[model samples]
Target: MINWYPGHMAKAKEKLKENLKVVDVVIELLDARIPFSSRNPKFDSLIGDKKKVIVLNKMDLADKKITDIWVKRLSEEAPTVAINSLNGQRINLMISKVKNLMSDKLNQLKRQGRRKKPIRLMIIGVPNVGKSQLINQLCEYGSVKTGNKPGVTRGQQWIKMRKDLELLDTPGILWPRIDDEEISFKLAATGAVKEELYDSELVGYKLLKVLKDIISDTLEEQFDLSQVNNDTLELMEDIGRRRGCLMSGGKIDRERTGNIILNEFKSGKLGRISLEISSN
Candidate 1:
């Protein structure tokens, strides 16, 4: 079992509940590559009765066909849009959907002859899922600090995007306990959890296992392997040898090799791969 709920995340969860009273809508960002595993199950209870717009970030790094399937499936539950935050793809469509969701409430307020208010949105997701980057793209400036690693944002801050739009950026929070091992591996593989918390070699091997089944041709082509074998460990060793991740005694440096594989996968050097696919 892999469990990592830090002190700050606990506090962040409480803060989110309290802040929920004020926000009008929730923008739940998810990793497009691992949509199922990236979602925190606790959010359903936490975001009770609030309108939600699911934004699948990092679409540029995920398989396009898989992402389109996910978008269609997820839209049945809420307004879903696939966006590449780094390049601002489909961002305008997201904003339009949010506005549409709130159109009724906005019209009601107008009927009462009340003053116009900004649409308060809270952005929530697992760590390093591109919440900060999404906010920056919406604002067209870097209003918050961002890093490739998890646990970058430690507090809540309100950002003004426009006269009628306001965004609340919250720290990424995970569930108290992740009982599912496959979910844990997916989280670790996608950088949702810190690299120091788990064994990278094991995660890398698991990643290879998934890739070999889904995109064996791409994997072999990327690593210059003649063929992909059933033994993932042997495949890792072969990759390490090809990439020169070796120790002084002619042994493969497993840690270094693991990091290399993970970095390449995360950076999309292994091609556009989606760890999870929509069944529909």
Candidate 2:
């Protein structure tokens, strides 16, 4: 369940309109695990006819098979690349791709005698998808503050990375409307939404159910279970037992176990898993 936009997010809509005209290209980041759900329906309308490139970040943490499927699926409209921004090495390739795609604008600027000016690119995405990290990586670990939590970027700020490239790092923005329940669940289950509204036990159970369908053997191995079981609760109990999360009276600490499972999944210890699968 996605919580509605906060008061701060309302201001983002105003800021978005404020800066839309100045941006030459829009680098919209999509979480590789939940491409469709992570996409804001209003993006096309918000971005208008501006050059758009979809950066599928956190590829290292997502199921490769599913990522490939999404790549093929999303390639129909925008140029898409699967990248791990934390690693830094993949960023150059991403920048090169963006530069190539925005060459028409570069030519137009050249004709106007402003070719040497850095290309202004606006980076926008939902909170916590590594947008700030990507910007710092692209600019060689420069001055912008980087944090694990969302909304570190505030107001309109320009950072010059290279002689020909400048970045306008804006705060992460979410849409005002989230109409799909399934999308909300996937987002919540994966911690792509906020953590305050999520119950670790519920999310873990949901994740186990999904893994059992897609990668049962991996899930079984990770939790040290001998066999795949029909019941999710039974599997979670086994996981808790293996992890030694027991209460004072020796009862299984389901909530603790759930937190551990979800943490491992978030940290990529449960291997690359994708909550949302793309339709062909």
Give the TM-score of each candidate: 0.95, 0.91
- Which ranges of candidate 2 are over 4 A from the true structure? 111-115, 177-179
Among all candidates shown, the one with the greatest TM-score: 1
Q: Which ten residues in a row have the lowest lDDT in candidate 2?
A: 184-193
Clashes of 1: 0
Clashing pairs in 2: none
Q: Give the top-scoring candidate (lDDT).
A: 1
Q: Kindly report which residue stretches of model 1 are placed more than 4 angstroms away from their true locations once superposed.
A: 140-142
Question: Model 2, 1-280: lDDT tens per residue?
Answer: 4566877767876788788898877898988888887777777888988887888888998989999889877878888788998887467777887888877767888899974557788888887888877887777435678776566666668878753677887877787756676776666655565667667777778777777777788878887889878798988888898999988887888888878877787788878888777642
Put down candidate 1 lDDT per residue, 202-277, tens digits, no spaces.
Answer: 8988898888888889888888999988888999999899899999999998888888889889999888889888
Which pairs, if any, clash in model 1?
none
